[model samples]
Target: MPQVNLLPLPLIASTRAASNAIPGRRLRRFPGLYRWLLPAALLALWQAATSQHWIAAQVLPSPYEVWLTLDYLATSGDLWLNTAASVQRVVAGFAIGSLIGLVLGGAMGLSPTLRAYLQPSFNALVQIPVLGWFPFALLIFGIGEPLKYALIAHAALVPVTLGTMQAFRQAPQPLIEVARVNGFGRRQIISAVVLPAAVPVLFSAFRLAFTKAWLSLVVVELIASSEGLGYLIVYGRQLFQLDLVMASVVVVGAIGWLIDRGFTLAEGRLLRHRLTPGARP
Candidate 1:
């Protein structure tokens, strides 16, 4: 035969069409561009409900009213003060908990005997919700800043411990063996092989721990605090100022979202080497 083509003409045409379908495919490639769609729709619905009197104004303030209340809080300086206090507690707790978790998890991962001895107790303890520890924490810490620190620390510790241990356990055996074969010492192997491989998991663990710590701080503030974002929410509800309550809620969510985005950016910067070429950060 002078020429032969195995593929069908329709299949080749369809493949070319898919390759050239930029306008139709751009949305799928960059879905993040559409994230605001749902929020915008919800806001429109909320405004409509408020204008139509479908929901009582007293029960659910308009978004504009909530914005006004947020402005007042900001200008009066209560918002910054509460936010700073919460951030302080989260920082202190997360630092202490992450240190302890790293040490414990490293020990367990390195020693089978240690893991066997501690795993059961750790598992049992983690099953109890952070709120369940509140009474004991209150009794021990006396409803002070220490109480918030302790609860946030507890919330942070579990995820970090689990993540570290799993990272160690799942580290590739071949790489570790190669390190040893190349005359690497224990420290060298850990620094060059183990830690590098575990970076992604460790970052994820830190993110989870940070979230847990923040949430625990809010709960503790709500239950027993003189000041913090959580206290603002409680105070607003107590005064039946739905606008204040909504404002505080909005601020809390926005802060959490910003913090998460910050972490994601940091992760992308620190772990860019692990990402494939041309991938989105």
Candidate 2:
């Protein structure tokens, strides 16, 4: 099949030049260091405020107190248990949601008739926030694991579906015409041209979906769960243990940062390959 380069030569040359530049490496490293400045400042402020009693213990515990609480939870294994539960829910729901989204979105992209039939309803349904579905899901699933899964799945599904549809729809018409001129069939064209072109956008969609799923998982656990990081927060609040609440919040943030970093690395590798000259099929 004939392959067309949608990007101009000058753009490709510039990209290659930027990638090899010493300034680009410095620019990347600078951001990693620069991004920590604010967080460090915030931590310092937090510590000072608590140490000086500017904030009450009931309002916000000292950083040392939060650290002790985190250590205690870790030693007791409750932290690991709750963290695992939350991660498991997000992974399961995200997988199910993204799979279904890919199928539905692909079909819609391939068939205008199917898109016409489904797009309106999907848009209307997806407008409802995860919390808006909480009461309805609770009614149907009755505060069980299924309730949490349903909400998280819905959260993941909306973004992935929209992204997949857009990615497929945005495939260059010239490329499609070129594929057809080369006697490529529908499946061949999709596999050889469309999928490769859509990789970057699809990765972005997956990242967004995972974020939504993770957030929805926490919210669901907060409202309905007996155990999970969110439940740990609720439990801490009920007992007026601000330190435990802070510890759980810290764990949540840390996990989110780690997962986002993982996504970034994965995206960087895939995009590096995709952006390489003569890489596309």
Candidate 3:
């Protein structure tokens, strides 16, 4: 240290700028490479673990083995059919629950009368676990599709309703006043003012409800079903087909991820619409 000559902040900024410039120039060439890189690395790691026999191969099959089983399922068309069934059930449950939740929640949040009559019972019922409802669901609808739908719907609706109610209740007072001053009727106020303000929260509730519905479908299928992906896992477990089990697990995870991604995309589009030039009051 002949001399303490610190690089000036401007020079540090210039260096960073120069370094980033090269990557910026190369960005077009590497578009989307990072997207698949993480998954590939994970697959590689799993393959390495299986090769090293860190856990018994029979217990935790290699990535390739799982893929092969997946391929078999795919080729036979069973995977698509089963996946479609599970997806439909999730959609059905989410749709029904979200619709009812929005109406009930909006009423409860907006009017004191509705809240007084409904909130107590709804709050208490939410405490009951999804598993606990299975027995009653089975008794009500039997071991049929309706039973699963009923269970999934109940599991999903509570959170959605609660979230919607809270979100609507907390809409800015100034905005509400503005809506009324603009001669908006009660229906118009809710449609134009309250709903827009609460959209983000409502969508969040939808996402939660969808996740709950998906989980409920799996549980329902596992407990009382002849088909579906969860049934596939149950079958694999019973038959001691670890590869099949792992493959089915991977499928379930992938499907759930895809559903979430779809919802996120929809949320983004909806938000974009709400943010346009003249959307708000």
Candidate 4:
């Protein structure tokens, strides 16, 4: 039997037209424009708020004032010095923590007995807030670089370990089977099959670990450092310079955003060939 149209011609045309327009209407297709809209709106609102005096200047300085303060800090090299210190600390801590996490997580993931033994204590220990470790760390490290590094490393370790464990455990079974069919040894199977499959998740873990390390850098500096963005914030507060504080905050946020964006771009490039056309991994 011949199939008949279920709708009128105009209705069909309209539906087709709407479907055709859908691609053009998708906001994510223009991600840069979409992403900037909110920030632009917020900036405008901030300008309005300050100009209209809706908020007191003492509490929240004008954006212009913050910009001026940021300019002054940059000119004086204070911003760069503090930012470099923070970055160095974050890099050192993240490297140490992530390396340890990968080793420990890999061992535990490969050996169920090891995981069973460590999982409970590991989970319990991670439950304590980063700040909760402060007293002990302070007593042991004495408000120095070691304390900052230890705390930052502690912050970075948990996520990377969990992510690495999950990544190893979740490697595609089909690939593992294929490797086994070829009589690949355990090490070869892991290196050739599991490692490639786990790259995406591992990258995510590293990104998260870096974020934690960066945040912990600020926290540690806030508690006991002479120089860093967090210390800059403290200095501004002590001097009652809201503009300076705001500038420091903006710099911190901007730097974190830039670094995270770099990671995201690198991940995209690294995994580009793995994804099918029009499909996300």
Candidate 5:
């Protein structure tokens, strides 16, 4: 047999060219940040417009005023306390809702009979606007923590269930056959093949569910409950405190941003191997 060369000249040249073409290794790895630059510019423009009173400061409190409000709230420990309470409630409700979504989704995904049985009702329920559930949730759970959980669960269930079921149904047939040829049992096939294959799609579902839970928390608070970021907005409205309302809006937007950031981190960690450039989330 002829001896083979371990290092091919062309391969070496290609690797060097790729490395040199990239701006930097770190920058290449984080192209996601580049897209956020536009949003950052928009924020600066908005801050300038508001701060200079280009618009009525009453209608749009300057970012500085909001920051000052935040600082005051922070010094009094009021911001932390209220934020902590809201966080706990939203997190708890989201966890339970996500769990339920995963279970029900798995059940339908794996079973044609179950899917047939549940599909119509599931589709119907999902079509109802989530905010419309507030009155019913209140009637059922009565202005308590249960209402929060119920409403969030309602918001989270659809995207997760649909994404999971659709992902599994669309799993590559060849991959399933490979698992079968290896003599894997149903559970083994699901654990080894289906879950890994479905994960990237499920990550998208998770992102949707988290957003739903966040918004649902606010809605429930505004309508029924006594506390949370939503309540902060409602309280401001009732008192005609536009600055408070504007401040709370900024806080809500900030919380949403942090939550999305957490998801991006989690996706990078969880789907490290499968994530590819330019793939749909």
Candidate 6:
């Protein structure tokens, strides 16, 4: 027998349509189109402020002037040189920090005794801000690449360690039991079940670590380095070239955005298998 249609036809059809809609797909496909709106508005506001003299030209150069400075820096190779130095520092420091963090965090996660022994000291140390370590770092490493590397690595270590420990600890007990029931060894269970579950969290940790390392590199450069993006900013300020300072800032932000986007893409690819069937790419 045919089922009675109790609901209104319009409501039933609308519900069906809504259920089948793929909003996330649209968002993924047109990300730039949507994401550029805020930046565009800000640019407009900046231009308006400059034209209206609401901000002094000496303090906040026009966008066109900043663009010209950026072009000059790029053409003269200054921008690339400074940027490359900063990138190299970030890579070296982040790699070392992340490796150490993973080892310590994994050990702590797998053993309650180690966690109890280390966590208190770790928490206490991490409470000290990055700048607070500058004096000690200077005494130990001096005003050189070693100082930059030490500081950047220290900035990265905290987030990665915390994220790794929490991720492993929070892994589903049901999954672990299932693995054990299947005769899996500790290593096998960790490799197949625990790591996969922790991938998303670890990736988030990497993002945070990378950002911190990048910022720390800049701060270290500002304090002691003769070259790098941070130096360019300080140089501009010393010479009263606000446009140059702004240009360096713009480059820094763009590079950071690109790095973040790269990590996001990697996370999506690495975790694709864990996504729901209808999840966006």
- Give the alpha carbon lDDT tens digit for every residue of 1-281 in model 1: 57887889999999889888975588779878688889999999999999999999999899999989999999999999999999999999999999989888877877789999999999999999989999998899997889899999999999999999988877789999999999999999888887778888888999999998988888888889889999998998899988998998898889889888999999988787567686532
Report backbone clashes per prediction.
0, 0, 0, 0, 0, 0
Compare candidates 4 and 5 on lDDT and give the better one.
Answer: 4
Off by over 4 Å in 2: 1-31, 278-281
- Indicate the TM-score of model 4: 0.88
lDDT tens digits, residue span 128-236, model 6:
9889999998999988898888889999999999999999998889999999999999999899888888889998999999999988888888888888999999999
Q: Against the true structure, what is each candidate's TM-score? A: 0.87, 0.87, 0.85, 0.88, 0.79, 0.85
> lDDT (CA) for every model shown?
0.90, 0.90, 0.88, 0.90, 0.82, 0.91
lDDT of 3 by residue, 1-281 (tens): 49875999899999989998987777768987777889999888888889998878878899888889999999999899999898888788878888888888988999989899999999898899888988877788988888878888887898789999999998888988998998989998888788878988988898889988898889889888889999999999999998988889899999889888989999998888878988653
- For residue 207, model 1's alpha carbon misses the true position, in angstroms, by 0.7
lDDT of 4 by residue, 1-281 (tens): 99999899999999999999886778557857777889999999999999999999898899999989999999999999999999989899998899899998888777799999998899999999899999998899987898888899998999899998999999898989988999999999889888888889999999999988988888888878899999999999999999999999999899899989999999988788577696433
Model 3 per-residue lDDT at 27: 72
Overlapping backbone residue pairs in candidate 2 total: 0
RMSD of each: 6.4, 11.7, 3.3, 5.9, 9.9, 7.0
lDDT value, residue 107 of candidate 6: 84
Residues 209-238 of candidate 5: C-alpha lDDT, one tens digit per residue: 889888888877888767778888898889
lDDT of 3 at 20: 87
Off by over 4 Å in 3: 1-38, 279-281
